[model samples]
Structures are given as structure tokens and as C-alpha cells.
Target chain A: MIEIVNLHKSFGKNQVLRGATLKVEKGESMVVIGGSGSGKSVLIKHIIGFLKPDEGSVMIDSVDIANLSENERYETRKRFGMLFQMAALFDSMKVWENVAFALIRHGKLKDKEAKEIAVEKLRAVGLVGVEDLMPSELSGGMKKRVGLARAIAHSPEILLYDEPTTGLDPIMADAINDLIIEMKKRLSVTSVAITHDMHSAYKIADRIAMLYEGRIVQTGTPDEIRNTDNAIVRQFITGSAVGPIKIEGVTA
Target chain B: MIRLIELIGRFVEILWSTLMSFARELGKILLLLCATMKQLILPPFELKNTFKQIIEVGIKSLPVVVITAVFTGMVLALQSYTGFKRFNAEVLVGTVVALSITRELGPVLTGLIVAGRAGAAMAAELGTMRVTEQIDALETLATNPVKYLIVPRFIAGVIMLPSLTIVADFVGIIGGYFVGVTVLGANSSVYWKRTWDYLEITDIYNGLIKACFFGASIAIISCYKGFYTEGGAEGVGKATTGAVVLSSMTILISDYFLSAWLFK
Candidate 1:
């Protein structure tokens, strides 16, 4: 469903992504595992047409999204729903309003209909009776659940999760992982998630791709990744400090 | 001699870069203004959001604008009375207060107040949105952040600053009247007559025109700073400060050019 070829991005003198490339099949859950600042977010941003690459193209279903006009890009984005790392709920809005935002704004649904759908999606994400509460009133886990509810509210064809399990307790993170699995099953949509949490990645991803430096270093199933011979992949999965992957801002 | 020449070269280089940076920022601000204008005229007018912003930017700012205008008028009256007393020109105090409030003080004070109040709030709110990724989330939901977020605020600023200035002008004139007639013991009829005779409709309109420009500058600059905010919480703080400072400076600096053009 998505193909990123030879993608390169630089912020001034800092070169982030260099020749990064990856692809994901439709209706499959693809998880990208990377350390912090590995350009995982940059890669997904390109897919969503949020950022144009300094080089190469991001193709979605055969159309290069980078080349689309602003209006056309907005049209193409309707198929995507993203849950940000911070949940990124509109603090000004109620939980239900946040969930129903795309529905009322883009889908042009009536408020009553939108609210009903928002409530339904919230329930699906195991959240109930917190619809009217503001985002500031919600717990971190609850916020993530609300974000998930919002992401799935519009019935998007492609769902993107950015560090969905981060900043939550182990149990909450695992719950989020389970929710990701449940969402994939229920919606049958293509998903691309980026995270450094190996457990969450293993649990939710049908296929896992490891992003290193700025490029995809390896792609494999969870079992294959766990048993891989590649030193970088093995070191990453094992959570070893001593590895070929140099820890940024640290002297070896 | 060689060292002096090197220092001169370095200074020139620094000056050139600073000028270039200023020009670049100005260009970006104009581009953002153009984008906002395009979105505003296009279909899907966010009347509801615009009204909401109008309330926030105009109605909420009424008390401060009124207070500032009243005090400014009173101060102007008191100062002019004292100064004109020396020349036996006490009768002209009303004319000075009315002319100053209507022609300059009303819009400028209102603009500065709104920039500090509404403009700072805009920068902080949008900066928070940017940092939290709510803006990106909006984009993913197929909404143009510019159209959804900026255009309404822009419309509200353009509409409300002038409305606030009108209120400021009236309240300020009344304030001058109160000081001149009741407190300062000037002739009530003389004060009213002089104010009416000297303050033209064109003077009021000129201030209002300046108000519109100030309003546009505040909204666009605030939105620009907030939209491009990076580096998280500290960045939001910096953007808020930059918005208020830049908007106020723009109002004051542009007031000169606007006054010269409109009054001339």
C-alpha cells in the first residue's frame, strides 16, 4: 500500500534520513522499530505527505504523494488516521469532540450522528462514559485510548501509530499493543506503527522493520527477527548496550 | 591596519546576514498572509469559528481597551491643560485630547493591548498544538490547519480590531469630556463644540484603517510564530513573547507610515 524509495531528508547541517527505503503490503500491520531520532517519524511523515523528501518519492498505491498539490494531498490524506506519540488530543476539545473531529469536519456528519459514532469508537477502545471530559482530565492511558478512538473513528483505510506504547506502564503498554492487534483485526486496515518497544512491536506487528541511522536495516517476522544472525538486528532485539549501533551522544 | 580591515569585513558579513534573515522572515509572513487570504475567500467559511474568535479577541478585550483609552484621554487632558495654561490656551485641551485619541491613540493602544492579550494567547495555543502534534493530527484527519486554524483567527482580528478601536475612540472622548467638564472645571459646551469642530470623520476612519493593518499584522505574525514553533515548551514561550513584541513593534512602526499615507 505504501512504497518509500531512496528517501533523504536533512535539517540544515544535520542529515537525518539518507537513502531510507521501505514498503508495506495492504491490510498488513507493519511496525518500524528504531531508537530515538532514527528518522522513523520522518519516514511515516513522508508517507502522509506531511514532509516532502529532499530526494526520492513516497508512493501510496502507485501515486507519488510528494508530487500532489496541497488540495490533492489533503484529499489523499483522508484515507489516513494517525495516533501521535503524545496522543496530541486537542486540549480545547472534549474527548468525544476530539474523536468525532474528522467525522464532523470531513465526513460532514451531523453532530448527533458524529457523537454517536465517537461514543461507539470510544467503547471499542475500552473507554466508556468519559466522552464529555476534556483531554486534560484524562489519564495518560486514557488519553492514548481516546487517541486510538479518534484515529479509528473515521474508518480510515490506513492507520499510523507513532510510539503508541511509549510513556505508558508495562501493563498499559501491553494493553495498547493488544488494542492495536484488535484494531487491525476489526478494521482490516493497513497499519504502519513506529516504536522502540520490542515487546509491543513483536505483539502487534505482522512484519517488523528495523530502522537504523536513517534507513531500514532489516525486515522480518517477529520470530525471524528474534532469531536473526544480523548483528545489528540481534543486538537491537536483545537490548544489548554493546553493539554496532553507536549510541548517540555517548563515547564508545 | 590588516586587523581593522578583517574586522570591517566581518561586520559587513554579519550585517548582510541579519538583513537577509529579516527579509526572509518578512517574506514568510507575507506568504502566510497570502495563504490565509486565499483560504478566507474560498468556500467553507468557518463562520462559527470566526465568531468564536471575535468574542475571544474583541469582546474579551473590551475592558482593557476601554480602561487604557479612558486613562489615556484623561492623562492627555490633564497634561494639555497644564501645558496650554502657560500660553492661555486651556480652551484647546479638549481639541488636543479628541484629536489625539481619535487620530492615533485609540487604534494604537487597542492594537498594542490586543497584541499582548489575544496575540500572545494565539501564539501559545498554536505553539502548544504544534509541539503536541495536534496540528499534524489535524492534517492526517484531512483538514487544512491553515484554513481551519488561521483563517478564522485572521478574519476575527481584521474584524475585531476596528470594532475595538471604535469603542476605544468613543470611550476615550467621553473620558476626555468627564475630565474637562467635571474635574478640570472647563466649560462643558466649549469642550463639546471644540471636539466636534476639530475631530473629522476622516480622522476616525484613518485610525480604523490603521487598526485593520495592525490587526492583520498581529494575527498573521502570531500565527506564523506559533505555526513554525519548534523545540517544545521553551519554543512556545519564545514564540508567545516574539508574537507580542513583534506585533507591538509592527503597530508602532507601521503607524508612522500609515498615518503619513492616510492623513496626507
Candidate 2:
């Protein structure tokens, strides 16, 4: 349901996306994998209108976001929910308020009704007796769960995950991965995720797209990604620094 | 020389771009306000949030404000008396003190002080949120960052500033009275009566109006800077400093325009 064509963006001297193009069919889980600072976040933001492409178009369900008015973009944004890399919960608000944030934003339900829905959603995410707790009070896994619950609270048609499992321990990360899979099956929502974490990408993505130098070099299934012969893809999946992906002083 | 020239050009460009962005963001706010004007009078007023913000920004700030205003009033009286006594028109000390404090100093100083306190804090809080991507997360949840987050502060600024300005004006006049009547051995009744005698309705009104505008300007610019903050922790620091400087400058500059308009 998303199409990006000839996307190019530059921040002063550094050009990130140069003629990058890609498409995802409806209800498809497309995982975009790239190294840190490889412009993956920039690309996802373009699709969501957080950052505008310097010279290209992001078409969501046939509506070119660049052409839409601010109000229209906002309306379109309602269909999407983004889970930020850091879980990005409003610290001042409690866990349920964070989850029911969309309900409040949609401006339909009253506080009492919204709180009920928020409690139910929190329960679905395996969080119990936690509505009163602030985001700072929760553990990393709990925060991620709350974030996931918030992302799905509005019943959004599109779910966007930005590094869904970066900071979690292995067990918690697997739990999150299972939740992603469970969410996909239960919601039937179109999912697009961007990540540098391989274990996360492989665990949750239905189809994997490798981003290199700001373009998708290869797009394939999980099995295909595991057995891919492409050098950049191999270097990336294997987590090697001494391959086609060269490093300076930093190690992954 | 080449680098200097380029720097000049870049500074001009940045200025132009900032002005444009400010215009666009203001346009967005105006449109939303017009659309929500009906909602303003509707139910679900969210008065709870409004009261919370007023307490947080206005009530909690009372101690510092009281100290600043009272001490400032004392200082202004002491300084103005020195100048007026040289001309042997020291009896007009009450008039001079009352006029300056009520008409100009009250609002301006209050604006500066609050801008330094609440304005910087607002910027820092919002800036940290922006850097941490919490603001975007707010948007994705369909929260109007302006309404849910900003309107409370805006309303609080408009309400609290006038009260604060009144306090400043009152404190300043008392300070002048202390210096004139007690310190300078003038009659207490005469000094107090003279202070009020010269104070016009417009003088107090002028300062109060200025306070409202100052409050709005500081709230808007500080909130905008923090809302649009990028980078990270350092960026938040920059936004905080920018908020204080920009709000202070806007208050001073706008003071000129407002006084000119009200007096012209």
C-alpha cells in the first residue's frame, strides 16, 4: 500500500537517498534492514510525512503525500501507528494513558470508556495491574509491550515499527517478536519496519528488504534472506565488518 | 575573507528560513484556532489540565516573582530619588516612580523574569521530548500537540501574566513609598496619596495589556522552539537557550510596538 519513487534526500553535503525506489503491496510485512545512519529512518519518515523527500513521491494507497494538504496528511496519518525505536512513551502519562492516547486523539470516547479500552489492550499485551504506572516505572520489556499496545490501540490499518527490539534482552526480544507475529495474525494490518538488528528483522518480517547506500539492494522472503548470495546482504546478515560493508573506527 | 562572506550569506539564509518556518507554523496555529473556536465554548473543556498548568506555571512561580518584584521596587525608588533630588523635584518621586513602574517597568521586568524562568523550562521540557521522539509519538497517537500540550500553557500565560504584572506594579510603588516616606523622611500619608494620585487608569492598563502579549509571545515561541527540536541532549540545551533569548527579544521588541500602538 506504499510506493516510493526516485526518492532523494540530502542534509547539506551528505546525500542519503539518491534515486531510491521501492514498493510494498497491501498487508505485506516489509522489513527494511540497513546499517546505522544508512538513511533507513529517513526513508520511513518520508513515507509517513515526518521528512519530505527532496525529489520524489511517497504514495500511500494512491495518495501522494507530498501533494496532500497538511490537514489531509494529518487525516492520512490517522491510519498509521508508529512504534518509535526508544518506545518513546510520554513519561508524564501513565501506562494506560499512553496506550489509550489514540482513543483520546481520535476524540470519540470519554475518559471512562477510553480507560476501559486501554485496560483491555494492556491486558492483551500481558501487562496487568500497570495502568497507573508511569513509563519510567516500567522495565524495558514492559515499555515495549506498552508501546506495542499503543501502536495497535487505534486499530490502525498500517503499523510501522522502528527498531522494535533494539534494547531488549534475548528473551524479551523473542517475546516482542512473538507479539509482532501475533499482532499481524490478529489484526491483518500492513506492517513496515526499519531496523539494523538482524535477529529482530528475521524474527518478525515476512519479507526482508536490504537497504544499502539508501536504496533497497535486495528484497526477498526470510528463507531467501538467510541464503542470499549478495555480498552486501551476506555481510549484513552474518554481522561481519570485513566484507563489502567496510567500517572505519566503529564496530557493530 | 571568502569564509566570512559565506558565513554572512548563510546567516541571512538561516534568518530568512526561520522567519518562513515561523510564519508557516503560525498559520497552522491560526487555522486550528479558528476551527476550534466553537470547541472552545463546547463541552470537554479539559479544565483539569488547564488548572494543572496554571498551578505548575503560575502558582508555583509566586515565591520567586514576589522576591524579584519587591526588591526591584525598592531599588527603583532608591535610584529614581537620587536623580530627582538633584533637580530639587524630589517631591515628584512618587509620580515618577508610580508612572515608570506601572506603565513600563512592571510588564517588561516581569516578562523578562518569567521568560527566564518558565519560558526556559518549557523549552527544555519540550526540547527533550522532541529529541527523544516522544512528540512524534504523540502525533502518531493523533494527539494535537498544540491543543493537548500547548493550549494549557497558552491559556495559563494569558491569565497569570496580568496578575503577576499587577503584583510587580504594586510592589514597585510600595518600594518607592518606602524610600520616599521612611528613608527620605517624607510624610507617609502624603507619599502614599501622591503615588496613587499620579497613577492613571491607562498606565495600569498599559502594563497589564503588555503583560498579556508578553505572556503569549513567550509561551508561543518557547513552545515552538521546543516542539521542533531535533538532534539530542545538546540540541535540547540549544533550544532552551534559544527560547529564553528569542522570547526576551520578542518581549522587548513587541513592547515597543505595543506601547506605540496604545499611545499613538
Candidate topping TM-score:
1
Candidate 2 lDDT, B22-125, residue by residue in tens: 89977864664454344445445657777987886688777777777777777777777788789887677788888888888888888888899888988898
RMSD of each: 1.0, 4.1
The residue-level lDDT of candidate 1 at A17 comes to 92
Error of 1 at A55 (Å): 1.6
Report how far residue A165 has shifted in candidate 2, in Å. 0.8
Whole-structure CA lDDT of model 1? 0.93
DockQ of every predicted complex: 0.92, 0.60
Q: What is the overall TM-score of model 1 with all chains considered together?
A: 0.99
| TM-score of every model versus the real structure | 0.99, 0.87
List clashing residue pairs in candidate 2: none
Model 1, residue A214: displacement in angstroms?
1.7
The candidate scoring highest on DockQ is 1
Off by over 4 Å in 2: A248-252, B1-51, B82-88, B253-264
Candidate 1, clashing residue pairs? none
**What is each predicted model's overall lDDT from 0 to 1?**
0.93, 0.84
Show where candidate 1 strays beyond 4 Å: none
Expressed as tens digits, the lDDT of each residue in B1-264 for candidate 1 is 999999999999999999999999999999998999899999888888899999999999999999999989988898899999999999998899989998999999999999999999999999999999999989998998899999999988999999999999999989988998998999999999998998889999999999999999999999999999999999999999999999999999999999999999
